[model samples]
Target: MTLLTYLVPVVALLAQVAALPATSSAIHPRAPLAGQFAGDIGACPPLPMRTTVPTSVKDLRPDDFKAVMAIGDSITAAFAAEGMKLNPVENILENRGISFTMGGDKGAVTVANMLKRFSPKIVGASTGDRIVSLCSGRLCGIGGYFPQDRFNAALSGAKVENLDRELNYLIKTVKEDKTINYQKDWKFMSILIGANDMCDVCDGTNLDGDTYERLIRAAFEKVRINLPNTVINVMTIFKVSEIWPLTKNELQCKIKRALGLKALCGCAFVDGDTASGVAKRKVMDDYAAIWNQRLLKVVTEYRGKYDNFAVILDPAGGNTPLTQFDPSFVSNIDCFHPSERAHKYMARNLWNNLFLDSTNKAQKWPKDLDNTIYCPTATDRIQVA
Candidate 1:
């Protein structure tokens, strides 16, 4: 029988496991994620605020930066919308071509294949180029994900578990190719995966919350091994139920649940077993919560982990008024994939979150140490009003 065929029963079993909701499952509610913008941009637990870096590559004066490279699935591909020549390859790679390689699917990716494709020629590249990376670039996926910011290799369908193979690939590549050292030139890496793991299974569908945690942990271990000193930033997945109706799938059921529709009363997006029914809706919330908790553990474990390596979470930084955006401009065209507009928003948000004001209000790059101190209490909120 085919793997999916063989796993049908297994998926059912997993769903049963997560379906058992607690009599009083109290979701730990925290403060609304504080952003410089207006609206319900959720926030994660407070991280020790680091002084923002005034100058990012995007802030580079005319002569300062060139060439940027992105590696991953469709999202990255979409980010490369203007074609390879206009892609970040110019800012980060300085004209050197990037080797394109990846294994992608609508709902999942495998670590094994990802490892097979990680070659120095692509990621490690030659010595002259810089790396500007993003991954789990696309959305709607199943398994095999590794979260790290060593290079922009984040891809959709990349689960937290797949980090081991990805890191191993990087380690092997660097070892074999003496000229490419991520430690010396690793500029920035972005982590935007995990939504798929959670979103893959929908209501009354299969599930496995426990294995998912293990996978995330495994990926963390691998990340530490490969890109120890790079600046790592993690972006939280968004609540998609509000946009469910916009999706092509019959997500009305999921939307109803999210909106407290009849059968979904009191159902937190991540409630397991009982949640099995709305597998699609719960995946993003559950996977993120699981990944976040474990990620915190990994962060603690890797404290002072890598030289200059740090983790920052940007939850709810997505363009707000998503419902109000011009349908033509709002991507995620397949209801699953991000359109060019979405990718542009993601790239800009990521760029601003890690280096500039989180509000995305700073009109210009900070000029000096003095300018760095100008971070305001909050910038103009991102309200559609």
Candidate 2:
């Protein structure tokens, strides 16, 4: 028999295996915890006192922001965020509406949705879909082509290297947006990137600590010079190397890896416990730590330098180890991306971080999926003085 004849039956068997449906309970857990909010804008309490408009960025409150923008990679893009559904294509769709940081989908517990509760006039939060085409590349689709992207300049597979493009797009979009008064309107921007860089460490990518710092500082400087009256929340990159042990044993994850479906992060997913694997993982961990330190340093340099621009370092995933989180928080599709439930959790975490002092922000991931959303008081400012 010809080799092609034998491969046809093997391919068919693999297709059948991939087609088998995953259990909803195992793949898409949705049971809310006791403290979880009902994903309602009405659930949020009103400010404790009368609203006083602030004239300075230092005095800006949550309600002061008139527009929102975000720049990052697939996490901000909300790639396959709905979890593993029946259709594999649907699994790869960018559910921008439900993204943890920038999604403005109605009834979704996202950072933008929570911000809306404070200021209904806030605009630019992304809504609807940005379908991704399957390709050999890590990220798919054009950046900012879809109207659904709105102020979310984030693109799939975006790294610190792509920050310049995303930033330029954001500046141009905000300038062209008729609803926004570019010079006067207070803008809130969130940035979460560098996972791809860390992931590519094993692949011989030249994204070391110094390069990461330089790229991030340049992005910040650009925003400082171009975007005024903006508060940038710079979230530290989490440790991707720590996630492998949690989901490595899952049958579906293993199957997907075998089929080459979940091969994005070589440092995290490739090579098990072999000597080379251990060495690569060590390198990844070291780079993650250095990158986070660089992020903090950049924030420190920019702090108090610009009156109209402020960069806050949000220690959400970076402060705590990923091993502390439940494995179920990961997406069922690739076993690396955050699930929708995790997105909600992240939204709460990011929202709460805005109200907290840098030193006081929650470091560890919430044990319960339904963690309490922090409500800001009249005295609370988004950027604490």
Candidate 3:
């Protein structure tokens, strides 16, 4: 059989997931926050949501931030940039002609980037101003391709194993600085981690589900203790497996995979066209599904405990086995990372979810694209040195 022959079972599996009727429960446009996720291999539910600003729905300008921070790998870094592109790019919603940091060049288009919408002077380490780090600090999510830095121990390319330490470091440093006064200033945090953990399993690194849960719990519990009143928005890991399936149609990606330019190639497929490789790929996809549910479970459990956390399901939608991403959602530079458009999509939807509580389609995050607020194209954005 040709290499393409393996797609049949995958297609069948998806039909089963989609054709099944939608089950009823208290469907909020948000996460359960209390009970289990009702997720099965073929019945994963919507991701969760929680946004506790402690600021009484008041307008939050960038200067209003006592501090905003993040923890994760490159995906999280997309918003927190250093001049080096690998530093951290957690998102500062600014409309300056250029985004002067690592992940920008495209823009600080993270969920936090949505702050730019409300008019805030978001600042960070690179700003060289006394109020810089006081406004925001993306202390984690440095860049390096998946599997390459999946399990690194350095502060350079942080992973799940490293998040708690990073949080501790951020807390210590923020505490030492007299500039931050927690009573009047609010803290916001975003954690888009675990893609590397999923990549680890895809690339032969160990990922124990129970251990992963423990790590997640440990990180959040630490955050709750150190930054007790912080409002945290946790984005769910993208379906890394979906990238592979959609990616198969792209000739350049296929050629790169055959020529050894892509690491995710191993993640989507195995050594050859043999049945074993196909089976392995299926397992990998199942792993993503299981873990996505696990993430929902973890967040819900913690929300019941902390009340400050929320999960951003692939707010772009089309993430389930039955659904897929629009090609424009991923970066053209590498089909792996989210595109600038995708980032704006998250910023828009996440903002809406936090701002609204209804599940109605109109009330859900606005699915419509608004390029007027910020340009979504890569070429349209000006790159700053």
* Model 2 regions more than 4 Å off: 1-41, 48-52, 133-144
Tell me the spans in candidate 3 whose CA falls farther than 4 Å from its real position: 1-65, 79-108, 116-157, 176-178, 182-184, 202-204, 269-274, 304-323, 357-385
Candidate maximizing lDDT: 2
TM-score of predicted structure 2: 0.86
| Best-performing candidate as measured by TM-score | 2
RMSD of 3: 14.2
Which ten-residue region of model 1 has the weakest summed lDDT?
A: 367-376
Looking at model 3, report the run of 10 residues with the lowest lDDT sum: 127-136
lDDT of 3 at 47: 23
- lDDT of every model, 2 decimals: 0.33, 0.73, 0.42
For TM-score, candidate 2 versus 3, the one ahead is: 2
Error of 1 at 172 (Å): 3.6
Query: For all candidates, what are the clash counts?
Result: 51, 0, 11
lDDT of 2 by residue, 1-385 (tens): 1111222332343444501121122111232121223334456676543455577778877778889999888889888677766654465578899999899888787888888887888899999876752211333334335887889888777778888878888999999999989888889999998877777787777587788889999998888778888899989888888778778888988887676644567777778777877888889888888899989888988777767888998876886667766767788766787888888878877776676666666665555566666556666777543
